[model samples]
Target: MDTPPRVPGLGTFLDKNTGTPKPPTPQLVTVASRLLLLAAVVQVVASVIAVVYAASPARLDAIQLQIDAMTGSTPSLAMMRNLGILTVVISGIATITAYVLFALFLAKGRSWARVAAGVLALLTVMQLLGITLPEGLTTVAQIVLGAVAVGLCYLPGPNHFFATVKAARS
Candidate 1:
């Protein structure tokens, strides 16, 4: 039996039937992936801060007032606290999960991941724009990191990598 050809730097074997080699991850993709990971870390830290704030008695009282105003009935304190914690935790997990997944796929030269990362970065910018100024430094860092990651994804090296993969598959 013949040994399959290995793709250098990718640690992946060429396709058995078509013999197309997997493209090595471009430097741009590597940098973008690291940026995405950094963004995720920032999000996690923000989430922790949010959770701590939500756990505070003053914030809980504010949430209770809003709930009472909306429903005309006061929810139990425990229920309100649980809801706040759940919301922060779930949203944080989702945001981090998305960033990590995008980074992983983009590093693999997946074309769809590049599109997804672009759309996410655009949406994040739009959301930031809608918010008032004087946002936390963490928010600013997130925007900058996200922008850099999206920019790297569109750089020539990553673009060429995606094109090579698409051509090979075709």
Candidate 2:
């Protein structure tokens, strides 16, 4: 097959079959991919913190208080501790797993990953807002990181990457 001549200043050559120029991956996409991965790491750390907190004595006390208030009876400390640990471990692992998968897909230029990340970030922010005040520094930081990650996904570079990939696939 004969190679098409490169277009001046465009850096891409015209496809002889389609008569269209296929642009290369933009630098912005590369930056956005790295940011997405960083965001995933941040989320994983937050998840670990959550699990730790849930397994802590403070969390057990909170659960005990709730059970007492709801049932007019106090549960055994061991029971509350076991339940809290189980709940936290399972939910935290699942959340971290999902975030990692989303990050991987986003880095790979998948449009759906961006959408999922955006949705998750929005939900997290909304949930945080529902709280009367910032719970702690960690909570605040997690919210900020989540918001930043979502914003990065919507930025021109990442947005264009997702759009271009989708268009090419179609």
Highest lDDT scorer: 1
Task: Indicate which candidate wins on TM-score.
Answer: 1
TM-score of each: 0.79, 0.65
Model 1 misses residue 167 by how many Å?
A: 1.6
lDDT (tens digit, per residue) of candidate 2 on 1-170: 99877666332211133443334655655555555556556666666766677777787878878777775566787877777677767765665666677766666567676677767666666545445342344445555655566677777776787687656544
What are the lDDT figures for the candidates, one per model? 0.78, 0.63
lDDT score at residue 90, model 1, on the 0-100 scale: 100
- Residue 143, model 2: Cα distance from true site in angstroms: 2.8
Residues 147-167 of candidate 1: C-alpha lDDT, one tens digit per residue:
888888777778888888777
